[model samples]
Target: MKADPQAQRRLLDLQAIDTALAQLAHRRRTLPEHAELDTLARELSALEDERVRAQVAVDDLDRDIARLERDIDQVRARKDKDQDRLTAGSGPARELEALQHELASLTRRQTELEDAELELMEQRETAQAALDQVTGRIDSTRQRRAEVEQTRERTLAEIASEEQFKTSARAPLANDLPADLVALYDKIRENSGGLAAALLRAGRCGGCRLELSATERGRIKAADPAEVVRCEDCRRIMVRTAESGL
Candidate 1:
């Protein structure tokens, strides 16, 4: 491509901006906050599962307690009826003996019911403790997530503003350059991780920081102004200017 020297330099500026933008994008993706948020999300999910299980345990214990209470009531009623019959003294020996046996069975059933109720109470207490812990963990995780989100939002906003500034800086170059040159620059940028062009500073390719030979520097200095030159070491478009000090 045969572009004016100044126009080609402007392309180099555009390339610099693109490089910065790419670096910023990479930083955003690899930020520590991103990984922290992911970790917190996993913990939150686990806490929610524990909370659900605790709730189910509590509900099951409640049902068990209720059933035990009903059983105790039925046993007490039977015992009361048999005691009344024994006190009436209108029954034979066999009948009285049967009443005594019924009373013993009822007493044993009541004892068993009371034991089950105590066991359920203990289980309920344990479940409540677990639920509290799980709830606390959830709240903690949510707070951390909110903090991470705020940081992410601030970082994203900063990156956007920086990108906007770069675009503004690049606007002046776009009008003077041809479409084909710009397309090539964009293509190189994509493949080079946004470092499409680099200055030949101090006889070295600034992008790769590789020093050039005496012959290579002389050749580049003697090249026609309209010719596009790439560095032999890094294959980046070489911009030779006063900044290059070559």
Candidate 2:
């Protein structure tokens, strides 16, 4: 492909813009906030699981306490009925003595049930505290995640603006070059590593950092100034300048 000597030099400028755009894209993908958000998401998931377990424990304790209270009420009611019968003196002496013994047993049973209920209540309190703690941690982690998301969004917006600016700058510069030259550069860039045109400095291919063979350098030296030269090793357009040392 043939392009003006000056147009070939300006190709380097286009390459610089393309390189900057590529770097910005990489920066956008590698923003630190993305990793932080991922960490926060995992933390929240684990905390939510812990919270569910704690809630289940509290609920189980609640059911146990309710059942124990019912048992205690029934025992108290039975003891009350027996005491009333003894006070009324409505039974034989033996029967009254048996009623007294039964009353004693009911009293012991009530005490035991009351003690068990107390222990269950304590357990419930502990379980409730644990549930609250896990819930609080989840809320904190969610808040942190929101903050990180905001940071990530802000960074993305900044990168987008930079990209827009670079793209706008690239349009006119690329338009100014010959269409065939730009097409050739684009085709090579697609196959290469986003670097189609590079300076031939100190008799080296800047794209591959390889020195040109003596014959290759001689050919380029003899070629017309407007001729588009490609690196033999890497097939990148070699733009010559005074620093090329050709």
Best of the candidates, TM-score = 2
Instruction: State the C-alpha lDDT per candidate.
Output: 0.82, 0.95
Superposed Cα deviation of residue 106, candidate 1 (Å): 1.6
Q: Judged by lDDT, which candidate is best?
A: 2
Give the clash count for each candidate. Answer: 0, 0
Q: Which ten residues in a row have the lowest lDDT in candidate 2?
A: 37-46
Candidate 2: residue 171 lDDT (0-100): 100
Total backbone collisions, model 1: 0
Task: State the lDDT of candidate 2 residue by residue for 36-122, as single tens digits.
Answer: 988898898899889999999999999999999999999999999999999998979999999999999999999999999999999
Tens-digit lDDT track of model 1 for 14-61: 877777877878887888888999998899888889889988988888
- Candidate 2: clashing residue pairs, number: 0
